[model samples]
Target: MNLFAEIRALVIQNLEAMQSEGVLPDGLDLGNVTVEPPRDAAHGDMATNAAMVLAKPAGLKPRDIADALAGRLVADDRIVSADVAGPGFLNLRLAPVVWQGVVGDVLAAGTGFGRSDMGQGRKVNVEYVSANPTGPLHVGHTRGAVFGDALASLLDFAGHKVTREYYINDGGAQVDVLARSVYLRYLEAHGQEVAFPDGTYPGDYLIDVGQALKDKVGDTYVGQDEDVWLEDIRNFSTDAMMDLIRSDLKSLGVEMDVFYSEKSLYGTGLIEAAIEDLKSKGLIYEGVLEPPKGKKPEDWEPREQTLFRSTEHGDDVDRPVMKSDGAWTYFAPDIAYHYDKVQRGFDALIDVFGADHGGYVKRMKAAVSALSGGTVPLDIKLCQLVKLYKNGEPFKMSKRAGTFVTLRDVVDQVGPDVTRFVMLTRKNDASLDFDFDKAVEQSRENPVFYVQYAHARVNSVLRKAADAGIDTNATPDLALLDHPAELALAGKLAEWPRLVETAARSNEPHRVAFYLYELAGDFHGLWNKGNDETTLRFIQEDDHAGSVAKIALARAVAIVIAAGLGILGVTPADEMR
Candidate 1:
């Protein structure tokens, strides 16, 4: 059903034939050969670099190879013409029937039209939005959550066995701060006035957690010291915060398959086990690190610490696993967590981190490399900051979150679909400006609206045809779809399968949003063309067969858009309000 793949196979078959006929050399590496859309539509429908890629290897002139290949390519019924462009690039114009067939294929496949098997069922673990379970998620974590969830969906569509995971940062000092904050709230719930110190959380969200604790214990821990209540409250508060986070994610349509607890790695010997695995490979040692660059020797006090030889596995320097006080460093638990992932037998690991964690990438990669013995590949994607603007100024922070806007604030303002689509309109590493006014705007300038309008327009066409009593269920005569605009849309639809494969290979889910925008543009372009020419309209008056064929084409476009939006975790719009 992938026309480009079928055409490429044809080209390869013809090349093999040429080799047998001695028209070309016996062997030429064709791995780099590629077929894609021509840079300019004026050139041709599709373009191939096969001639250019093989010319030097075969010891033949570029034009000479192109000429021979063009003749063999035209012999197929699909390709009508193959013309050589500058320096042996072959531009191909497929027959109208070939483009027409793509519409029928889309109709038959529905939303599954672009699903690919490129991953070949390899197990991939995508860990994202591993924010500290101290409070509800913020705007930064929102971007990471959407990016990771969409990536998991994209991998699944591309045939990978994906596990959506969230790592709870409950083992760190942050949770202790949260427990103390809740304890103050608990005192307030017991009719005691309390002032939150600088180090504790002051958000009103904890007020309920305090009251709930009172409801459960009923004055059991009243006026107790930190030693008696800290442990119990830490566990209790973490569970409450996680519940809030889960509810926030569900509101945004993100659900994780696993919520990994960082506390489990502690007191479980997992950290020691992970470090021992590194020790067995001679990667662990005790040494004093050199003073950081630009630091005067007199100002630096170097301490001997237990370190991992991360430099051997591509990190900039060796990393310390244990602090001078003998407590595990922050990086130790992270290493153990990733080692556990590798031990779970995943073929690949992907971590979605906030932009501030860019410096931590190399060390984490080194840890996974050493733990998996270079077997599992780790790809870390860092999502940059999101700047919110509204009413010609910066958006106000959420009072509930205390310091930043919560994910629920964004979702509540412009439902989940718009929030998800607008978040992905930019690349993960690039900073994004999420303007409240512009996100819900109904104009071509807004990409989410533009794409959704296209789907809604198609539904309108089907509804109108149904009301007119046109038998759309009848087999569509695809041959009647011979207009230039109709064929152009079909050509765009043909690119879907290839687009999915490329996006999945690069681990970029934003490309799906980009492609949906382009597809919508093509569809809207054709829809507008019907205004100038009566014959170009999708529903031809009194011509049932002709209308059915064109309606079939429009339906096909909607199918692919829904499929693309589905991968992005946005529900496709059936009607625009």
Candidate 2:
């Protein structure tokens, strides 16, 4: 029931008719032809660029083509009027019945009304919040978790088979630091005083993990040296930290379909295999790299190292896969991780990384491009920092995470819904300001509340109508819905299918959030109009059939709002009170 699509099809059909009549030349590329809502609603219901795009190709003037196209379009019952705008744009106003049909289609399709098959069941792997298996997830990972989860749902709605993945960086030196930190807490559990040095984690979150270790194996590693206990404690501590991270994510309504272990890439030959794939393409070689642009390391001597010819793809410089000391560089394992994703037969890969990892983006894409032989497309989204405020001042740090706020801290302060919604209010690349004072406020200024109140108001109308003995179960007589206000709401409803396709095509889930807000605003405006004009009210006291038709319109809005919120992992509010 995409009215824009339907209108575009009609335009293409008319163009084909014109070509057959030899009015326009054959073989004009119509790929660039687009039909969308006019910028100014007063101009028309929809506009098409078909005339402008085909004019030069057909060796005809834009206005001439537009005049011919307009004539063919108005012949159809759906199109009430068609006029040529500047140069060659075709602006169209649909018949009133057309808008009524859109509302009816929404009720019939229900929540699946806007679902798109644009992705065509392609497999996509989305990896996010791969926070080191060290301690509780902090505020930084919260943005990525919400963004990735919403994006997975969006892709799924657009018809992509998506897998939500979290890569456990257990093979890194950070996990070893976590192991030693937990060992100190373990000693403290055994009644031994311990001091956390500069590199050790001093957070009290590890205190319970240490006690758990003692409970599992009492006195086994007591007074043991690093060589004897390091490996076992590393595995044990990392598992416990992952459990903490999983709990943190669950509290925020995030669930991962896969948790890939970096350690698995180590013991197995996956790294060798991934590098071998690149080597076969003559992309891997032993070479020396120029020191990084801004800063050179203290040990800055140029030495031969295993490098990937990332420059051939799109990276600014070739990147090192192995250090001079024969140890796998950090980039090597990441390359292997992406290779594993490609081997799993996913048609696309999306990585949600923190802003600091922006420098790592190009090389990572180059690796996936080379490994997948450009068959798999990879997009890396960088979530910027979040600034927290309370009582109009900067929020204090958590004693648990020591230097930053934990995800649990934000969730506990305001429930997951507010946290998730406010987090998405900004673009992933822009810095987000999460205000403790304003987000939970039950006022129109708060977007979360504003949008939820709109949904709740619709529910209120249905409940009141039911109490007033208006037969709410009757099918809406959509033909009676021809008022300007009703038609306006229906026109907004018609944009949902197109919005979903565009948002999913760009891999941008924030567009969903923005669309939901605009829809809510339109709905709220219509509701307010009912206050001054009794006829615009959803419930007509004396007319049961007209009331059912209006209620149907309100219900249709609620249905799409709930579906959009579901995609964002947000629970639709039933009542504001």
Candidate 2 lDDT score relative to the true structure: 0.92
Q: What is the lDDT of every predicted structure here?
A: 0.94, 0.92
TM-score of predicted structure 1: 0.98
- Per-residue CA lDDT of candidate 1, range 1-577, in tens? 6677778888889998999999998868877888888999889998999989898889999999999999989988888999999999999999999999999999999899988888999999999999999999999999999999999999999999999999999998999999999998998999999999998999989999999999999898887889999999999999999999999999999999999999999999999999999999999999999888785778679899999999999999999999989999999999999999998999999999999999999999999999999999999999999999998799999999899999999999999999999999999999999999999999999999999999999999999999999887789999999998899999999999988888999899999999999999999999888999889998999999999999999999999999999999999899999
Candidate 1 CA-lDDT value: 0.94
Per-candidate total of colliding backbone pairs: 0, 0
RMSD to the true structure for each prediction, in A, is 1.3, 1.3
Worst 10 residues of 2 by lDDT: 1-10
- The TM-score obtained by model 2 is 0.98
Model 1 error, position 205 (Å): 1.0
